[model samples]
Target: MNATPCIIKLSHISFAYPGSDVDVLNNLDLTLCQGEKIGLIAPNGSGKTTLFHTIMGLSQPRQGTIELLGKPMRTPKDFEAIRTQIGLLFQDADDQLFCPTVLDDVAFGPLNLGFSKEEAKNTALETIHELGLSGIRDSVTHRLSGGQKRLVALAAVLAMRPKALLLDEPTAGLDMDVKETLINILNSLDISMMIISHEFDFIHEVTHKIYSMENGKILTDEEVHVHQHEHVHRHGRHPHKH
Candidate 1:
């Protein structure tokens, strides 16, 4: 048996917003091991964002248990304790970069994590440089291009030195060059991650496992194959693993 640690686990999770009977996350489940990367593929409104929110404690599930950092996660406090360790890249980069300048935005999380002001600034600068973002370090956040904003958002997340990342539609609205750059950046990182994306080729480029969600359940191997994306992933004459 593999001995690697499982950092996150979602079991029989179910949820529905108030006054709505339809469950966005109906008995959904997922597991992430140390250094394991996965690509979650499902159509829009398949509880993808809801699952991310639930993991971060932004949304509460109606049923099931969540495990994080190898322990049961059941409270707002539990979520808060682990929040810094699990970085989430929202679908909209704009939602993440609220600070006036790129440097401030990158330094924000570290500051909240109680880093000394000097340490936070230094950490942010290092992260920005490592991501090849030094060019935009002092730029106005709102003035940056879409791809630039996305990269800066990522830089901010990395400054916290998280153990895992949850990236939602990370490559959306990016040009081919910027998409390639982001892909390369993600590949170089050794941290654990679960990437939510509709771009099959992009997903295949990064993740070790391809997880498909259907009717709110993460399909077993017998239930599906390679994220239900055999056709699209191979659209460019690229073969996928069986």
Candidate 2:
């Protein structure tokens, strides 16, 4: 049996937008073990992104508690400390890459963490090299292709060396080769992760376990497999596939 400790624990988490009558997350509970790769799948508006926001402390929950790396998270101060231990990858690479050059963008986080200029640059270069992106170290962020931008965005997050990663739609707009590259990189990393994606094939490729969400709740049956078949209806013996 795997004896990895829990890196993230959310208990009885309930969240609702201010002045809204509905709760996007209701008593949601989740746990991510160290070195575990988990995937969450759900249709649009199923509260998957909301769950990420809550975990990242971007959104406050109405009730319940969150523990990160064995430390309880309560106030903004707690989240401030927790942020360094958890990296978040936004669905859109453009949202995270803003610096003039890829190296500068990847170095931003280390600089903010008080690493010396030389140290930050070195860390960024090492991270870029690890991601096999050294060729574009000085490339303009906006000019890079979609796959390059995505890898650079991820390099920026990895430079911080977070213990866990929360990725939202990491493979949304990638071609086959890019997707394969991402899968290889993710498989090589020894970090815990909670990935949200609609691409079942991609999810299955990288994650060890999978869960489905519905109406702000995670379903109990975690064992999920993708299957395709046609269904025959009684209406004049019509057959259709979904």
Candidate 3:
């Protein structure tokens, strides 16, 4: 079989926050193929979010290199042009949604990318429609339920038509129905995905591979068993890990 092209690459990467003694990520190397679905497993403070930030260009590494789409990454502008190619669903829905109305919030990405008002609105409308949020398009963003808010945030990223989607704790705090809905939505999307979640069962449902992280390093990368919902994690126990 031919080797697949990498959509994302990281080599010997390390990062440390200001005033912090420990590195959040240390000498980590990762490569993501064009359409792979990967579940990132790790405990809280295990550098999962830090890794996502580095990939999204929200933060810079103190050492080593990151390449997205075959080019070295530096600066917000380099990531800005690449932003439309990637969608990030932050763990906190409140942090992701800022505009007054759902339509405007969802349209933010396309509008900033220079799409006309009509085009932005139309794209946002289509995404919301796909996510079954048409009824809430004109509603105030802050007024939506937690699950609905997550959907709206997801729609905002989906509106950009990204090639890779990174979701942080997507199933966290969500009820079973909402979790199932989100799982179905993720399963239906065709793009590559890197999901960070403590919900092992849910991860098994939507992803084909697992990348386990511990102590600021990647421990294992393995294929998912189609019929297995439970994962034997080396990380500490969570609600679903029993």
Candidate 4:
């Protein structure tokens, strides 16, 4: 074993929505180490997004505990500190892009961290360049394409220089070329990540390990290569692989 310290840890975490009878996360336990890429896959309504929300401190677990960067989170202040080190990429890019221009949007996090205005802008520009989005540095965010918005959202998070990233549906609306670009960018980063995506191929390419979720529980934890397979089925008489 490599013995790397855990950057994020959840212990017996359980959560349910208001007025709902069923818990979305049933005593879930998970951990992420530095520099590890982990993938999560599950059917719709299986609580993948809920898990992300819980980790991001948007949804509190009714029981158990959450630790980010080895610090236990017990209150909103604790979570706020945790958020500084664990950046979350919401499924919708619009939720993260609020500033007037791309540069402002990307610099928002660093500015909040008390960086000088010039320092924040420099960091934002460097992150945008890394994502191959420098051309839109000063462009209006609302006028950008869907893929550009997603990249901008990611750039905003990257500018914060988080130790770990919680990404949900990162490649959902991206084209093949954009998806490839994102994969390359993510691979080049030296940070830990827990990515939830329905795109199995993309997950396999980006992650070294995989976990399956069902009924609000993790069903299995295995190496990505172990679960690689081609499933063939027929819609009519023709065969297709998925």
Candidate 5:
């Protein structure tokens, strides 16, 4: 079988907001292969969201390169082409849902992408039904609970049929049951994903590879090992490797 190509690549990247001397990502190097479920863990203000913006082409780095699906990304239009292939779930659902009603909100992307009115509406309705949001399709978005709003947000993105997903704090305010539902949805999706979150339990349940970030720099990058099974002793004592 032919090998799948890398979906995201960042090389020696350095970035800082204008007028701010601090670099959010300093000479950062990161890559994601196709079908990989990766978790990015970092504290608040450690550049996790900044990295997402850079990857989404909402922001640019002061130095270095970023390539999405083998195409060099430098302009908004360039990012737009790749972005259609990548769905981003923002940390705040409110940030993503601007339409008055759920159906309208979910149809936003496809409509903007030049889908016919009928096509966009059908896509939105199908996604809403699949996400179990059909009952509330006409409801006002702000009136919904946090978890429900999150589902609606996810449905909106899925309606676009993105090839990859970048989710930021997907389960932030979700209760156990809703979180589990989200986990199941993540597991079932065929797209490549990169999730940013602080909830270790949530991240470990969804992703196989892990990257730790601190002060805008990556501290650890490796395949994830479940803490529960990783502490076992191989002999009379814990085995040490160097």
Candidate 6:
């Protein structure tokens, strides 16, 4: 609701996976407001995925509180009740896609959420068609191309009609046309989002503000900008006045 200012709030959160010596997340604090789109930038092993897991309650934090969609999420049950409302697109398409076909994978979420078979099928079909994936609805999930797999993974998430989307490397291995279409689709959505990507340009274009994660913390930098140089230059050439 617009009345609720924060869609996600993690305060003083600290977490460490089982058998880990150190905390993957160390007193991290992050918030996503309603209708806000933000980007998370960090290298691999920087605990970006851990942070998302903590928010989703896949991994519980040893300390601190998590509030989602204006309510506290302290237990697995609490998080489960709202998980469908906040879609999480996993970084690995293989991890996300397990059903036999593209249509099955896409409709799985809605089915789990109590949509009738007809309703779920229709939703999946509409989502697939909208994403230009109609041709692959019957295609084998594990046999699709890398780019197609990524897009199908996204289609699965979008079919849930989440109020908030947590996308991890959604553009990885996508083609130029697919990337552009993804960008346009994301920009058109009126939902809260926190995208984690190493592609600076894609993040910059889709999110209103960008933050860099360091040492299990989100370093706020809303003014992140990327500049382009139009002039061409040759490799291994030095620049000097004639």
Identify the runs in model 4 with alpha carbons over 4 angstroms from their true place: 223-242
Taking the candidates one at a time, how many backbone clashes does each contain?
A: 0, 0, 0, 0, 0, 0
Per-model C-alpha lDDT, please? 0.91, 0.91, 0.88, 0.89, 0.88, 0.89
Looking at model 6, the pairs that clash are: none
Q: How accurate is candidate 3 locally (lDDT)?
A: 0.88
Report the backbone clash tally of model 5: 0
- For 1-242, candidate 6 gives per-residue lDDT tens digits of 33658989999998887898688788988999998999988879989988888888888898999999889997789998988899899989999999999999999999999999999999999999988899989999999988889889989999999999999888988888888988988997889999999888899889998888877778887444444444555643686543
Better of 1 and 6 by TM-score: 1
> Clashes in candidate 6: how many?
0
Per-residue lDDT of 228 in model 3: 34
Q: Give one digit per residue, the lDDT tens place, for model 3 in 107-213.
A: 99989888999999999999999999999889999999999999999999999998899899998899999998998899999989999998789988899888888
Q: Judged by lDDT against the true structure, how good is candidate 2?
A: 0.91
Error of 2 at 226 (Å): 4.5
After superposing candidate 3 on the true structure, give the runs of residues whose Cα lies further than 4 Å from its correct spot: 222-242
Against the true structure, candidate 1 reaches a TM-score of: 0.91
- For model 1, residues 1-242, the per-residue Cα lDDT tens digits are 86888888989999999999999889888889899998988888888899999988899999999998888988899899898999999999999999999999999999999999999999999999999999989999999999999999999999999999999999999999999999999999999999999888999899888887888787643554653333454446665565
Candidate 2 backbone overlaps, count: 0
Ranking by TM-score, best first?
A: 4, 2, 1, 6, 3, 5
Q: Model 5 segments beyond 4 Å from truth?
A: 223-242
Give each model a TM-score: 0.91, 0.92, 0.90, 0.92, 0.88, 0.90
Tens-place lDDT per residue, model 5, 1-242, is 97778888998888999999999999888888899989988778889988988888888898888899989988788987789788999999999998999999999999988999999999999999988789999999999999999999999999999878999999998999999989988887888999998888888889988887765666555533335334445664655763
Candidates 2 and 4, the one with greater lDDT: 2
Our model 3 lands, by Cα RMSD against the true structure, at: 5.0
Worst 10 residues of 4 by lDDT: 223-232
Runs off by more than 4 Å, candidate 1: 220-222, 226-242
